[model samples]
Target chain A: MRWIRETGPVVGAITLALGVGAIVTALTGYSVPQVFRHLAVGAFGDWYRLAQTLTQATPIIFTSLSFLIAFRAGLFNIGAEGQLYMGAFFAAWAGFSFQLPPVLHPIVCLLFGAAAGAVWGFIPGWLRAKRGANEFVTTMMLSYVAINFTSWLVAPGGPFHGTAWANQTVRIATSAQFPRLLRGAQLSWGLIVGVLVAFLVWYLLFRTPRGYELRAVGQNPLAAEYGGINVTRNMILALTLAGALAGMGGAAETLGTHRRFIELFSPGYGWDGIAGGLIARAHPLGAILAAVMMGALRAGGQAVDRAGVAPADLAAVIQGLVILFVVAPELIRYFRRLVRRKKLGDIEL
Target chain B: MEILSFNLFISALRLATPIALVALGETYSERAGVINVGVEGMALAGALTTAVVAYFTGWPWLALIAAIGVGALLGALHAVWSVYLRADHVVSGAAINLLVLGFALFLTRVIWGWRGTSPSAPTMNAWILVGVGLFLIGLSQVYIFRTPWGLRLRVVGEHPRAADTAGINVYRTRLAYTVLNGALCGLAGAFLFNNLGRFTDGMVGGRGFIGIAAMVVGNYRPLPALAAAYLFGFVDALQMRLQDYIPSQFSLMLPYFLTVIVLAGFLGKAQVPKALGKPYVKEQG
Candidate 1:
């Protein structure tokens, strides 16, 4: 029964996505079946494509988990985008600045990224917990600050500047890169890390005392205080952890794929993670699945464009439709049942 | 120095006008107990609609009207989902943003055969619109404070159940204010496309978000919101003016940095509408 309830929304969402694909195909003058086939082929037809999809999905998993962790503690950490960028900047800095042994180098860079992200996350968390500030507005403002700060840091004549084609930082050392898990594809060890983090998050939320306290505080801080939970401490810890996860995602994208820190590397992945977390209702495993679906749409949308059927914007349409359908499954089901009943009456009468 | 000062003032006012309009729009929604996170998407849809209509018809006024109508329609969709259906207002707003973005992108590609819409637009005199926009802002401030409807709206925002007992139609008031909010945002978008003589993909780039920050810093009051918007515009103008002296990127970051500082400073003391993000469900006896 629990499984049925969970699958209900998922099935509704898939149906909605399919309906949208059909509409897009008709509008764009392409065959619906062919477009679907092309998307499948482009995303998972072969080993290479599957690897690409996994790689694309990896960073999102981390960021989505980050969002989940904070949300579980009743914190809306909208600064994840800024945190991710800052983490990437720090990781890139550490990667290029030092020449440590291969194993230690990557570890150090990852830690550096995590630390940078945590600091960024901690600011809003501290302000909100201590002064009763609204986290949403503060975090949103921080995102712009982070983006501009990073851009300035990487521009020519800045500290992190390299041989610049545009305003960007230098590439990291070869040893600093996350080791590739497969040859001829971009899949790296980051996917394993992302999966491990998801399991760890699940454990932390469900099996740990700290998690209980955080959840309690989230449910009702006043009551949690009566229960002897330190609400302020939990709030700060949750935001810091959330920031670390998002930062790691940023580091993974840089080390595994781009190999360099660039301005605007994220096409709003942090915001996408927020959407993914909300869709999953802050469940760890659910977030992983939701992130993958988002990643698939993005990865496959590229193929949809190449198939001479639709443009990249079609993917956005499908995404919006999926979210709408998921949130209001009853409406879709009701309409479908209405249509079916009408058809049945026509046949019998 | 004289040339630079003249250009800075113009650019500042130009940048400030749109943000001021959007923030003022949000002021009403927040006061009426709805958080309008779809401002970015609303602006995008409005700008795109204005560009397309103005391009074919070559009538700036009609295009402006179309933009406002479409924005209100989008707001209606938001109201139906968040207010009537009782969905999470923030999530509903996010869904609307994604929907509008997707729809705008699709329609732009289909109608213009261009990846992004960039139509040749006729220029409307900025001074006229700016003056009118400012006047409206002042009127909204006065109307929101001095009128019975304004008092009712505030009562609804602060405590919907109490307002309901007092015979205020909470849902209807919220719906009306949200629609009006959408119109103001649409006007801002029109200013971007027509006043600027052209529109780009990033024309309203993060101004919607900045407008939200302005509202927060302003404590949701109309005059203070305008002041915050002007402060942001001043920084933005300064950045452009000092582009020669400072690194352009750092200069560009000035407004955002100020947003962080201002938010941090004012957030602690800001008094939000008590029932701001809460939905009011009528009790069954």
Candidate 2:
């Protein structure tokens, strides 16, 4: 009953968003029913589509977890995109540069990715904690810097540029790549790892004394400080942990899916993760489900493209509307107040 | 001497126009205790409107007005969410950004059979807008600092309860300034469209964020904010020239890096309004 009450608004927002998308589709001279049918078929029609949906769901799960942990600590780590890129690049670099045994190779590369992301996260964290800088702007700025820095590394004359004509690194060794779970689908062990990490994050955020301190800081920093919680250290720790999580996501993408560090690889997965975290109301377990929903929308958008129903961007429209509706639940409360006021006036008359 | 030529100076001023306009607009909104990070999306929406209207009507002035109208509409939406609905300002702004991007992409694909780019359209003189922006910034300095209404605006943001006690309408002031901010962002978009005579989704890029940075560097004052915009504009112009000697990617990172550094140095020191980002709840009798 509690779960249903909490998710009631989320469900309503999703339904409203889809309704808005349908209206948009109709206005654009497309059949709404056909477009939605294709969306459903594309997202869950068969094993292959289901695999694709899970595959898409994998990275966002990591990023959403990243957003959630930082949010719980009273910080916004929007720099997951940059951290992911750094992690992916380093993970790929490790994959191609060294020759090691099968199990150990991927493990080392993942560690390298996480370490790099931690370093990236630490800079803005330290700045915010020590120097009174705004993390929101700093994280965004650092994201642009990381993107450009990585792009330069893969461009024609950079050291990491592979012999391939495309601006991508050489493919990782077979020993470093993640084994595929399905015979003909893109799904890999990354999904399993992502789920495990989500559970771990839930435990850390809810079942630990440290987690309590962090939540206290988010709730009231001055009070937390007076209560003997080191607000600065917690802020730094939260962003660092957030970075590591996003870094692992990037590493998983490199090891399990891409097999190479491609230029400009992310399609705003970081931004999608922000929406995911909010949709889940910062709950770790709920983030996984929200991420899957986002992934399904993406998969369905691709399907819409193939079926010639409408442009794929229609999916983004629904996602945005969902965010707008979810964030403004107060709008509903305001309407309720207005109705009550009208009733009071009628009674007076 | 070769790098700081007359052309570079002129180009710097031109590049500074949009940032300065956004900074000026943000100054107003922030002064009224509302943070409007949706400037990026508002600008993009404005540019898209300019292209569509200009393409159909071939009237640049009408396109500019439409851009402003669309921007004001988005601003009104944001005000409703943040002020009345009491949503998080940043989240509401982020939603507007995402919504605008999706709508821009969809419209482009639907109308022009292109995903993100619009064809060349009829345009007016972009420098005219630049001149107008500079003029507004100058006038705003006087209006904000040397007028009776300016004191009321400051009081509303700094001590809203007091302002309300003094019979000033806090909610109306905030709504008006947010809408004004959005209209200014639209004008910035119109300038971009006029300068290029075309529109692309990525054209606005991070200029809007940088504009906010300039506002901080300027200490929330209009004239100083314009000066900060000019400094960033100079770096942008210099980077374009330096692109011949260095990788464009490395040069592109300079402005963002400088913004972070500049913001880090200036954030805590800025005279931030006392009631910034806090929703004022009126006590019912």
Q: Give each model a TM-score.
A: 0.92, 0.96
Clashing pairs in 1: none
Question: lDDT of each model, Cα atoms only?
Answer: 0.80, 0.88
In candidate 2, what are the lDDT values of residues B1-285, reduced to their tens digit? 588899998999999999999999889988998888889889999999999999999999999999999989988888888888888787788778878988888889999989989999999999899999999999999998999888888888899999999999999999988999999999999999998999899888778888988998899899999999999898888999999889999999888888888887777788998998788899888
Best-matching candidate per lDDT: 2
Residue-wise C-alpha lDDT for candidate 2, range A1-349, written one tens digit per residue: 9988678778877887898888988988988998899888899899999889888888899888988898898888878888888888999999999999999999998888888778788888888898777676777778888889888888899888985688889999999988999998879988988899999999999999999988899889999999999999999999988888888888899999999898899988877877888888788999999989988988988998898888888888888898888878786555556788898875632
Cα lDDT of model 1 by residue, A55-160, tens digit: 8888888888888788888887766788889888888988999999898888898889889888888887887787666676667677777888888888777877
Query: What's the true lDDT of residue A323 in model 2?
Result: 85
Clashing pairs in 2: none
Q: How many clashing residue pairs appear in each of the predictions shown?
A: 0, 0
TM-score of 1: 0.92
Single out the weakest 10-residue window by summed lDDT for candidate 2 chain B: B260-269
